[model samples]
Target: MRIEVNGTPRDIAAATVADALSELGWGEARVATALNGDFLPAASRPMQALRDGDRLEVLAPMQGG
Candidate 1:
């Protein structure tokens, strides 16, 4: 299936948010995710289903002084 990741189109074989993260190499990374403009909690990621044309935004924390 194809979905938009951080504004870029990507083809993934994951059916859920958690799997997608893993497929995208973000399984163990601390990041924030939003689906279709709604915030998705870590606990809910496992249950969050993904669909074609869906927009997924992933943002990682940046440390600066």
Candidate 2:
């Protein structure tokens, strides 16, 4: 399926958000995810379904002060 990730087009073979994360190498990283402009909690990622042309935003915390 082709979806937009952080504004970039990406093709993935994942059925769910959790699967996508793993496919994108973000499985073990702590990050915030939003699908189609809706925020998705971590616990719900495993059940969150993704579709073609969906927009996914992934943000990881940055610490530097």
Candidate 3:
């Protein structure tokens, strides 16, 4: 499947959000995820189904001001 991740095009073979994250190499890292401009909670990731051309944003915490 093809999707835009963090504004870049990526080819991912995943059926769910959790699988996608893992495929992206996130692997248990602390981060936030949004799909199609909507925020998704951590608990919902495993069951969230993704479709073609979906926009996914994975954000990590930023420190220092």
Candidate 4:
């Protein structure tokens, strides 16, 4: 399946958000995620199913305030 991640097109074979994260090498990284412009909680990633053409956004925290 193909999904947009952070504005980039990516082809991935994943069933859930967690699977996508793992495939993107973010399995254990702390980050914020939104699917199709909706916020997706960390706890729900494991069950959040993804489909083709879904837009996913992942943002990692940065400290410097």
Candidate 5:
């Protein structure tokens, strides 16, 4: 499957958010994910379903000043 992730086009191998993270080898690493311009809570991430053309924004946290 394919979708636009953070404005970049890419191919993903998962149907849901949890599966997608697993497929991408991403763990609980402070990655903030917003689906289609909407912020998704951590609880919903496990069951969130992603569709074609869905926009996903996964960003790492920034630390230090």
Candidate 6:
């Protein structure tokens, strides 16, 4: 399936949000996501599903303090 990931087009086979993150090689500790412009809570990661043209944004934590 093709979904817009962080405003970029990418092909991924993931039935759920958690699967998508796994396909992206990202671990839960390093990324945050918003699906179609809605902020998804970490606890809901297991239930969120991606659709075609869905805008999935990944906000990586910045380490600067």
Best by TM-score: 1
Q: Ten-residue segment with the worst summed lDDT in candidate 5?
A: 21-30
Off by over 4 Å in 2: none
The Cα local distance difference test for each model comes to 0.98, 0.97, 0.95, 0.97, 0.82, 0.83
What are the RMSDs of all candidates, in order? Answer: 0.4, 0.5, 0.6, 0.5, 1.3, 1.3
TM-score of each: 0.98, 0.97, 0.96, 0.97, 0.85, 0.87
Give the candidate number with the greatest lDDT: 1
Residue pairs in steric clash, candidate 4? none
**Candidate 6, 1-65: lDDT as tens digits:** 89988889999989788888888887555677899998887779788877877778889889888
- In candidate 1, what are the lDDT values of residues 1-65, reduced to their tens digit? 99999999999999999999999999999999999999999999999999999999999999998
Where does model 1 exceed 4 Å of error? none
TM-score of 4: 0.97
The TM-score, computed over Cα atoms with residue i paired to residue i, of candidate 2 is 0.97
Q: List the residue pairs that clash in candidate 2.
A: none
Show where candidate 3 strays beyond 4 Å.
Answer: none
Residue pairs with colliding backbones in model 6 are none
- Could you give the candidate ranking by TM-score, starting with the highest? 1, 4, 2, 3, 6, 5
Ranking by lDDT: 1, 4, 2, 3, 6, 5
The lDDT, on a scale of 0 to 1, for candidate 4 is 0.97
Q: List ranges where model 5 is wrong by over 4 Å.
A: none
lDDT of 4 by residue, 5-50 (tens): 9999999999999999999999999999999999999999999999
Candidate 5 achieves a global lDDT of 0.82
